[model samples]
Target: MCKQSGTPLQDDLFLEETPTSSVTEKVAKPGPAVELKGSVFTLPVLRLKRSDLGAIEEALSERISQSKKFFENAPVVLDLEHLETPAEVLDFAALCSLLRTLQLVPVGVRQGSAEQQLAAVEAGLAVLRGGSVQETVAAESKDKKTGEVVKQVVVPSKALVIDQPVRSGQQIYAQGGDLIVLAPVNAGAEVIADGNIHIYAPLRGRALAGVLGDASARIIVQSMEAELVSIAGHYQIFEERLPDELFGKSAQVYLQEMALTLVPLR
Candidate 1:
């Protein structure tokens, strides 16, 4: 029997067995060898603050022990902003192997210096670009040769919308934009967006916003009963139940001082 397993939307794969070939049967024509599409995903980022592999292993073990299921086989991106200056020496292969042994998948590295990026590529990781916060400003610039004033504009994608209730096991994503749901989000479902997530109905599942590192993104819900919620990778899980003051009430989830903050929407 063929075995297939993965998350609902991110990596779900379908397979089927091929029938026995026979001369009497019509000749089978070959199909495309592979297909590719562009998609946006929200993955956890592991920022490296130090270059000590021993210390990193110890701290990583402790942190993963606290949330085993959440980190199991989860893809992650390395934040190498700290490794730029002084060019800290890093063992990409060793670090990646360690992450794998801990049941984590290191898919890519972002914001790395030239040498670090080369090292990551040698270690079979993608060199990604969008891990830093972005700013939208109407600023003036001068042409290099002519010294002429020029204007630059930043355009943002429109928010993706769902007009009906999101069922369990369903995953919705709003790439480069916000997300809006007109109905309830059932448990076991997930809604993700690169910007804010606005729900006109109750939220009972997981909602991840600001997946691209927008710290100002927020999740606004009509009724808040979410099992988990995250903004800019800072997350809060409701193990048992929410406090009486916030359970099933209109609420807003945002990031404050690099921490996840929840407040009533009164």
Candidate 2:
């Protein structure tokens, strides 16, 4: 009962043919273009010597309060090498949870026993090996009853040498090792190391040494025109123009009494 709706057919002379190639070109698909790559990076490690959680939480809270800027949301590698026994069972889930409550993210665990490794894996933590920082413990006894204290000496890794200039927008980090740059570091570049940093040529960018609380770390430069320089967490920014004596001069920067000190390189 409904009336039919339709367009009138056009005359053969009035009809125009359209090219199919143009339509195909518009709808054509491109080939797959995804690739995988690998790179190296640096991360700080937190060594654990005991399994007690309450004491650890209290101590960690105090430490975090002291250095809020560095501890907040920090990624850490958990080292279990300093424990009295490798076979000692630990509550990996509880440990990770406590760390997270303190804003410490645990990415991996190192130097643990087979069972401990499995527990960490079950807690969604990776097992790490042969990294720049390893087997280094700087933690106190977490056992409330035993009240035992342990100390560990960290042996720094070999120096990382760079023979070419570091261009702008480039970042170089020498984890647990000294960084030696034989060429200049251009502006907008960054050089960081956990031990020490040495530049044989002009340094116009930023240089940070002792990134992991190594107050003994130092920075030596042949021609120091750096925009910023830091030793451990102590830093000094050159807001105004650098002094003639300090700029383009051989200098050595170090930490003294928790302050940054710059002196002539002798």
TM-scores for candidates 1 onward, in order: 0.79, 0.55
The window of 10 residues in a row where model 2 has the poorest summed lDDT is 7-16
Return the clash pairs for model 2, or none: none
lDDT of 2 by residue, 1-266 (tens): 95434443553233344446654345668876986786554456676777789988988898778657657898988888877666897898999899998999999998888888888999999998755333345655445677666554566799999999999989999987899999999988989998899999999998988876678889999999997898865677665667887889999999989889999876
Best by TM-score: 1
Assess candidate 1 and give its lDDT: 0.87
lDDT minimum window of 10 residues, candidate 1 = 6-15
What TM-score does model 1 achieve against the real structure?
Answer: 0.79
CA lDDT, every prediction? 0.87, 0.82
Q: List candidate 2 stretches off by more than 4 Å.
A: 1-35, 132-170, 174-178, 182-196, 200-266
Residue 97 displacement (Å), model 2: 1.2
| RMSD of candidates 1 onward, in order | 15.3, 11.9
